[model samples]
Target: MVIKKVSIIGLGALGILFGHQLAKKMPRADLRIIADQNRIQRYQQNGVFCNGECCDFNYVTPEEPCEPADLLIMAVKFNGLKDAIQSVQKHVGENTIILSLLNGITSEEIIGEIYGMDKILYSVAQGMDAVKVGNQLTYDHMGMICFGESETGLISERVNVVTEFFEQMEVPYKVDSDMLTRLWGKFMLNVGVNQTVAVFESNYGEVQQEGPARSKMISAMKEVISLSEKAGVQLTEEDLDYWLGVLGTLSPDGKPSMAQDVEAKRISEVELFSGTVVKLGKRFGVPTPINQELYHRIKLIENRYTMIG
Candidate 1:
């Protein structure tokens, strides 16, 4: 089906970055922002400041009536995913295509269960060094989106429709036939950089430095690589090297999504990253001691937040 109307959920870094770009291409009215009432007010008042420029797009709260979108992009954090899904239920027509840019391997599963398997697509955003502070967004890299079918990893007509939309918007994206491998590859990157950054409260550059932190990051990623092979995903040592290279190229002072969450005193996606690794490791009979340690450390940090509240 041709995609004319697109709705982006969440106003986080990726959401705002992609939303602004899409607004530039599509009619501003054709692109919608589905966020909470507070976030809606914030955007309505201040607009979205992206890359030193401000752009305002149409927005609606979940309580308001929204026309079913042709495509819905899920960009909320893992913790907020359940509510986000429910909020956008009214906007999901029979043919609405769902693409989740949230990190983790299981977001597609969760979205599929709610929206039906056929409507869900596998996706990940990469190469972005963006950060969101309040209503303002700043980024050094624009990033590319990779997506495809979940079951066969083959490009379907729906996939092509989304690709054509991106092409028309001049948005950088790839339609991967092996989207599962790509997701697992990105999963490994998140397990390495995101968890370690949150635990140590460090940035990408610190993790890249030759030190114990870097060693911990590599060890955690190796655990993911081992688990991926056992799960029949064919992740290799070379894949690990490639992720390491990607990590090396990130902005020195840039913080990952998890680190940003920790700093903002918001809940991090430890459950998505380290939690998934630990669960999968148990199922696959693979040891994930490093991930376990990182998971517990992040939980303790989160628990502190709970206590403060």
Candidate 2:
């Protein structure tokens, strides 16, 4: 399929970043966003901010689900997948490809439950720190997006074409054969940075600079990795090298998504991030004490925040 129009279902940090870049590069490609009606109305009536870099654009919510797009990029919370997909699936064309930029290993399966395995792609983004603040969406990391065939192996040409298009747009991207390995690598990152940093109420930089906090981050990642191996997802030495290297290079000021969620007092995908490992520890008959403890502590903190809200 010769991609033309691309619709992003979420207008949060990553969504706005991609849309801004896509609009700039693919000028001909119709870039539509599926946002909350209120946010959409605000942006349509008054331009939305890309984290202080505001843009005046025509954005509209579907009144009653019309047609699907050539490509659909999903960027909602993991728990909100079904609602997010339902909102935009009607606009997804028969040949549409659903690319999930969310955290965790179950995105493809979530979409596959409805769209089938052939239409889904599991993707991971590094160095991307996109989030919503009021009417503005900010992405300080300017990261890269990597995606490939899930289990279906049906969209080689389409994947390549989309990846090339991303590259042309100055989005750092790569395609790998072991997509699951890539996913687990990120899962480790989320377990470490997203959860631990959120618990610290600090950004990536603060955590790294704080001696005790950084130690905690390392412990959390190691535990998550152990949980992954127990679940039969073998992570190699090279994987450790790449991820550890990434840890050293991460933006000092960047905060993990979980931290942001906690600050915002929004329901997080903790269950998918750390909680997944805890559940898997049971499934694989291996105990993940560190992860389990973090999961419990983080849940308590999250609950406290929610109750406060």
Candidate 3:
């Protein structure tokens, strides 16, 4: 299907970056931003500003969220994915291509139950940073995002449309035969960064810069590597370096969506990242002591946040 109008059903940092980029590239293409009461009003009041390499996006969210569209890109946190999907699915159509842009190993399969895999496209996003200072968000280090449907042997016309959109927006993206590999790779990266930071109570640089902290980070990554092997995906040493390179470029103060949740005294995605590794390890009869401990520690912090609230 040739996609024109699109609705981004989340107003998080990722959602904003995605909606803005889509609208910027195809202005004639209808792009709507759907946010919950969370930060909907503030977003609707400002629009995304793609000012060079800076997070100067003054994006104003649309007051009226469109009732679905030909394309629906979901950038919401996967922990609350059920609610997020339920909220937007009613507005979406059978023809709408759903893009699960959330970080986690479960997104595509979970969404598959709700909307068949045929209707859902595998997607991954990189090189974007977002921080919400109150109602406003700042972002930079704009990177590439990619998505496409695997139509068996049949050539996909939708893949070309998505690639064309990326070309215009200058978002470095690609469509590979094993998008599943890319998804698992991204999940492993999150398991390394988000899981480690939450467990250590530190930022990206602080965690990577310190000795013991860096060791913990590597141990956590190794656990993921083990799980990847059992799950039939081999993550090489060079792969570890590539992901770390992305973190190296991050600003010391720049935080992840999971970290933001921790700061706001809310539950985080430990279960989605490290928690996922530990679970898979159990299934494969592999030991994941470090990942298991980190998962529990972070969950304790997040649970406390929920309890006190």
Top-lDDT candidate index: 1
Q: Which candidate comes out best when scored by TM-score?
A: 1
C-alpha TM-score for every candidate:
0.95, 0.90, 0.84
lDDT of 3 by residue, 1-309 (tens): 566767776666776666656655666436665555545554446533333223223222334444557777788887768877776755477777778889977788888888788777788886566676444567666666756664433337767776766676666786765666667667767877777766666777776585787778778877777777777768777777777777777777777777777888777777787777877887999998988888788878877868888
Model 1: number of clashes?
Answer: 0
Q: Which residue window of length 10 is worst by lDDT in model 1?
A: 148-157
All candidates: CA RMSD (Å): 1.6, 2.5, 3.8
Per-residue lDDT value at 229 in model 3: 79
Model 3 segments beyond 4 Å from truth? 26-29, 36-68, 149-155
Comparing 1 with 3 on lDDT, the higher-scoring candidate is 1
Collision pairs in model 1? none
Q: Which of candidates 2 and 3 is the stronger one according to lDDT?
A: 2
RMSD in angstroms, candidate 1? 1.6
Tell me the lDDT of model 1 at 79. Answer: 88
- Could you give the candidate ranking by lDDT, starting with the highest? 1, 2, 3
Weakest 10 consecutive residues of candidate 3 by summed lDDT: 52-61
lDDT of 2 by residue, 189-253 (tens): 78877887877788877666648777777777777667667766787657765776776676677
